[model samples]
Target: MAEIDPDAKRRPASVKELKAMSHPLRVRIIRLCGDHELTNKQLADRLGVDPGTVYYHVRQLVDAGFLEPAEVRTGESGALEKPYRSTGRSWWLSVQLEDLDTSQGFAPVEAFQQELAEAGPASIASYARFALHLSPEDVAELDRRIVAVIDEYVETDTERAHLPAHGGIFLLHRTPD
Candidate 1:
């Protein structure tokens, strides 16, 4: 197991940074860039949005330090294109959804939903569903344990970058009556 540095801490997102990331499109942009560097035109094509619109959101992410310009490279058509890559800064920023507007707070979740749908059911590797009843303390402990496990994997993700990327979301919510 990789030892995590105890002194390392995730900083809370500032108002400006949080606002910059409060859009679902921006969240998707970050996720896509994480996989590889992408040019604005490529992003616009993959997202089925106007290049101008992606450029606007990309500018916002770059300003917020969530994305950075990568080395300029020649494309297949021998045209120079500037690509952007995710800075991975957002992974280290703690966002408190309660501090944001309801719609803004749901941006990440909405982005995940969209990505999952795009990936399709065949992409699902594993899944489980269950309901648990617990007191506040138990709930906190459960959350802590689950996060610790996930943190271990996240801390060492770069080691497995060559492997195919897998996405998962662990959501705990009240069961509807």
Candidate 2:
């Protein structure tokens, strides 16, 4: 059974928490564990890393409250194993990077590049990019619309067993003239 923490708090990530989650491997860990709880050994095998490395990052995520222990079970060796599940904080994270040093923001960009490099062009479902000049209000409105579409699609989808997992990156920034 999935463990539910009645006191699980959902709030914007603090700088400390963000830093904890800033590493690309950590982000991948969270994504891998999104649907199901996994042991460190399982995560390590999937991520192609050592279990010790995965365990280190998992501890950071659990400490940051972005993951929680789901259940304990027997492994192939008949030893106890603890699995963890995502807290869903990444889905609703609100980060204000204005006053903070934003070096950590590049983690996602790097992850995106790595995924594309691995998947190559053959696995791509869709790709599109647009360059637009607009006022601040127009930019805000566009952002809202984009987010709405993403949220609607994410929320409405219930049958994922037959669907392929998709990765998307939505980037909006003012270009230097």
Candidate 3:
């Protein structure tokens, strides 16, 4: 499940790409594509939308350069289908509340903060699925393992074709190293 681009490079998203991803469905679509390249039909099946709807969203993402063509496969019926991937591992949308204050004032800021707080919990939970009871020594060992593993991922400048089933680990732990 590890999402490996094999060719990942730190390419920042342009302003246009960021704007296109601002939509909630489009954002989710990007995340899903990050995990694996998929066709519009596959995405629609997974998202429970009609294939046409998924195709439209996918095209918009493609136009913004966030989505790249990955593969072309021939269907059993002889039609060629295209698979698409997200070019970057993640995206950030930066909104300067300070800048907005001069124009829109504080309500927009508060609303933005509230939405982030509400959305964060589920995103966190979806990503975290393990709990361990450990002694101090065990905790230290875990930390070592995590750091070593993370280092392994980052040590190489370029990623590979397939990541491990571990889904490209993002280890977060606070302990004395």
Candidate 1: global Cα-lDDT?
Answer: 0.87
Candidate 1 per-residue lDDT, tens place, 1-177, comes to 654442255778899899888998999999899999999999999999999999999999999999999999999999999999999888777666568998887788898899899899999999999889988798767766676677778878999999999987776766788
Over 1-177, each residue of candidate 3 has an lDDT whose tens digit, in order, gives 343332233345455655565565566577678778888988888777899988888898888877889979887789998999987634323333333323333333343444456456544423456666778799757755655555455545246646442223333344454
lDDT of 3 at 19: 57
Supply candidate 1's per-residue lDDT for 152. Answer: 79
TM per candidate: 0.90, 0.83, 0.48
RMSD of each: 2.1, 6.0, 11.0
Whole-structure CA lDDT of model 3: 0.61
- The lDDT values for all models are 0.87, 0.77, 0.61
| Distance from true location, Cα of 162 in model 2, Å | 4.1
Looking at model 2, which ten-residue stretch has the lowest summed lDDT?
A: 1-10
The residue-level lDDT of candidate 2 at 77 comes to 92
RMSD of 1: 2.1
Error of 3 at 116 (Å): 15
Q: Report lDDT (Cα) of residue 78, candidate 2.
A: 94
Q: Candidate 3: minimum summed lDDT over ten consecutive residues — where?
A: 92-101
Measured by TM-score, how close is model 2 to the native structure? Answer: 0.83
